[model samples]
Target: MAWDDKRVETWVGIMLRTGVMIAAAIVLIGGVLYLSGRGPSPRNNYRHFQGEPAQYTSLSGVVHNVNLHEPRSLIMLGLLILIATPVARVGMCIAGFLLERDRMYVVVSTAVLVILLYSLFFHK
Candidate 1:
């Protein structure tokens, strides 16, 4: 099957929207965690440029069991918003390919998505 350009664009839009929502959600969750006394936000359970989070750099990235409150909630929110921008751009491309009814693109996206999901759960 092949989708026209308009339909492909729609799919791309959907993916972009999804990315935006995900970014917003991550920010919201991070804010809640930080305001609750956790510390700096984390990319995830793991830290970048470093193997482990030194046990003190969990989601909060603060002292163990210590929860103070977000000193810069707005900043964290901004960072998340920035993160989503590029994500949305790329997501749109992928989504568009799928929506275009390109079987090749669809299969590739599915494989990539599956791999990503698996890594998220079991790559540790």
Candidate 2:
């Protein structure tokens, strides 16, 4: 019933492990789908060096493609989840610090969380 440091650490660890495992599973499934759809000898135009499509660059686009069962989009979504894991960890720490009445840590964690969000969403 207590929100102690050990308990918080344990939960954070669980969250990180679960996040990575889920991301890996999604990426693995996407890779399998990609390979299966590509056939035995898919094209490899290395010399051309075509970049990633615009659809995979934005969150909405990725979601749209994911809804359509696009393999690359699924991989992108997995990567996005992987990236979000640490941000979620920071958020959890903020909550833990708040519960512990640790003002200094709460302020520091909040700053870190804000910076992370700014960089992730607004730093263009």
Clash count list over all predictions = 2, 0
Question: How do the residues 5-98 of candidate 2 rate in per-residue lDDT, one tens digit apiece?
Answer: 9889899999999999999999999989988888889677788767778888776777677843568788899999999999999999999998
lDDT of 1 by residue, 63-114 (tens): 2333234434433444545554654454555666766667787677667766
Q: Spell out the clash pairs found in candidate 1.
A: 37-67, 37-68
Give the distance in Å from residue 70's predicted Cα in candidate 1 to where it truly belongs: 11
Which of the numbered candidates is closest to the native, going by highest TM-score? 2
State TM-scores per candidate: 0.37, 0.88
Clashing pairs in 2: none
Q: In model 2, what is the error at residue 74, expressed in angstroms? A: 0.7
How many Å off is the CA of 111 in candidate 2?
0.6
Which stretches of candidate 2 lie above 4 Å from their native place?
Answer: 42-50
Candidate 1 TM-score over all chains jointly: 0.37
